[model samples]
Target: MSDTLSPKAAKLHNRTLITTYLYEHKEATKQVLERELGISLPTITQNLRNLEAEHIIELGELQDSTGGRKAQSYRFAAKHRVAIGVALRSNSVCLCAVDLYGDTVQERTHAMSYTNTPMYYQRVGTLINEFAATVAKGGSTVLGVAFSVQGIVSADGTSITFGTLMHNTGLTLETISQSVHYPCIMIHDSDASAMAELWFDPTIRDAVCVYLERRPGGAVIVNGKLYQGPNQCNGAIEHMVLVPNGRQCYCGQRGCMDTYCSLETLPEEGESVPGFFSVLEQGEPHHRERMHTWMEFIAQTIVNARSVIAGDVVIGGEAAQYLDDSDIAALKSRVQQLTPFSTDTFSLHKSRCADTNSIVGAALRYIEAYVDSICTDAE
Candidate 1:
């Protein structure tokens, strides 16, 4: 077959290219776009006009010229449409509004607890709608809402296939989407966190993301994509057994990694992870010992995971933010001692979106969908 671009395909390709460049660079002039994209000046102007008419792009102040008339600048209207992401936890909910560029525009937390009853679902729907209403007041379109649940999500993102922690197993997407006046979907919290990492750093071809939250969970990225297993539980690393007949995990598993490496593992009876870290930083002997054990367990888990999947390990979630440089060095040393090969073969990375990975990732689901729809449109 001949390698040629049809007129329609070329138009679509140019539009996508121009829009993507503006989105990435924030702003550009018609001449700059023409020069950078290698498109004809008229074609660049036409695409810019179309984008501006659609409210996807807007005009910016003219740039100063060296020896000619000032050139008009165009900018991508990143916040023209926003996506909402909700993270449902056992005791509270986190709501975030993200723009097309995956930047969080607004975020809030609610003290509501999770209950599988219809009333609870209705309340969640109401909260989402109310939040959207506030966001819409800024004259921005609300594209959709995505829920990040700490459970196994169905392949179609329509139901919670496994949610023992929140007792929300079998919950359907419609239960909450019904009250909200926009597109919606369900997503696994770990999966969403992994997506956020991929969005933040597209270079991650293959890696393991371990979320050291109160209840540890993880996701796997294979070949630059999420590897959902047959049961869509490919990255349920928390359930991996670390010891036989040891401490019980919340999932009722004995000696699971969650019981040893989770943030919950470091805290005292009423101390939070932050409090535990605070004392640990102060050189308290008890906290120091607990953190040492925690790092050892985490190192072992990373080594075990690498034995099956070879890639960088990204440590994320609420607890990961507390990990300082010294902590990373200690963990790296521990991991090096466990592996036969050199530690230089693999690497450990701290999550850039430590606190908001799941929330941002959840919202990015719809933002990406919108961009895909635009880029894939043939007409």
Candidate 2:
């Protein structure tokens, strides 16, 4: 027999290659796919037709051909599937629906406290059902659900190893998954935010994402992936001791970074992050001094972290949106001073997703898995 792939195997391989290419490139013409995939025109046309029939790919605008006939471009129909992301906080739940393209098409906040009671889980399930109904369009399917919680999540996303906010430990995936019909996963809030940053900016292959929200925390990205330590506590930056005998952290640690760098440190009179930043922007001597001191502590933390992890530092969360370029520059300068080895400027970046990073990242988990599953099956 001739050495060739069986008809069925070849078709599946072509479909997988074409879909993966379009997913990465966003859109491509038949000719482009043929050339990039090293597949013949007939095979490309056949696979494209099959994918289009399955509502996976769709024809786009005609591309300008150098010669006679124009070519038709094809793109992945990203909105064909959706994923739900629920950020379970201490007193509120942020539910968001994201499409395959990582767009948050629908979102809403429901007021509820996190608890271990069955009633609470049932309430969350009801809210999820209602929200899914509201957000899912006629042709789109809910692929899965991801939960971003303020706690230490298991490596497999099946349970919460520890949670300080809920004062609970060993919270299993069944608690939330039983309420929703779709497959579910649980992730630490900081890790989700880090994933959001990585998804929004492809250039950031490795970095430490610092979240300065109501409760400060961090996530470490290694080789373009979240690095949960062997114990699943890799990015607990909040508990890092910044001062030898400073303010007390909720974790019962003295002089932790959370006590110094969190949003809680902002003056209460401002009422909100924007208002607090506004006060600092007004050029008041004391307010400016306070901000300067805060930046110093933040810089100190970055220097300390860099010495261990050696990657770019990304500042994110509610407070990140209020920080201007000058503020980042100031923080960078402080870091440069504190660091002894390199005179070069440290690689620092601001978060692109702002307040919605965790929720968006949560949704992306399922979207990413869906795509990976296709590739895996092809293999």
**What local lDDT does model 2 show for residue 83?**
92
- Give the per-residue lDDT of model 2 (tens digit) for 1-379: 1127787777677778889899889899988998898988998898888889988888898988788898889988887889999987788988999988899878899888778778888888888888887766557789988898889988777888877667767888997678887788888888888888888887887788888887888999999888988778988888899998889777877999999998868776636766677878888788778787888888998888888888899998877887889889888888888888875454897888857889889889998888787654353
The number of the candidate with the highest lDDT is: 1
For all candidates in order, the CA lDDT equals 0.86, 0.83
Query: Per-residue CA lDDT of candidate 1, range 160-262, in tens?
Result: 8888887778888888566777888888889999999999899999898888888888999999988878789998989999999999877888999988987
TM-score of each: 0.95, 0.91
The parts of candidate 1 lying over 4 Å away from their true place are 1-5
Runs of candidate 2 with Cα error greater than 4 angstroms are 1-6, 62-71, 343-345, 375-379
Model 1 C-alpha RMSD to native: 2.1
TM-score of 2: 0.91
Q: Candidate 1: worst 10 consecutive residues by lDDT?
A: 1-10
**Model 1 alpha-carbon miss at residue 334, Å:** 0.6
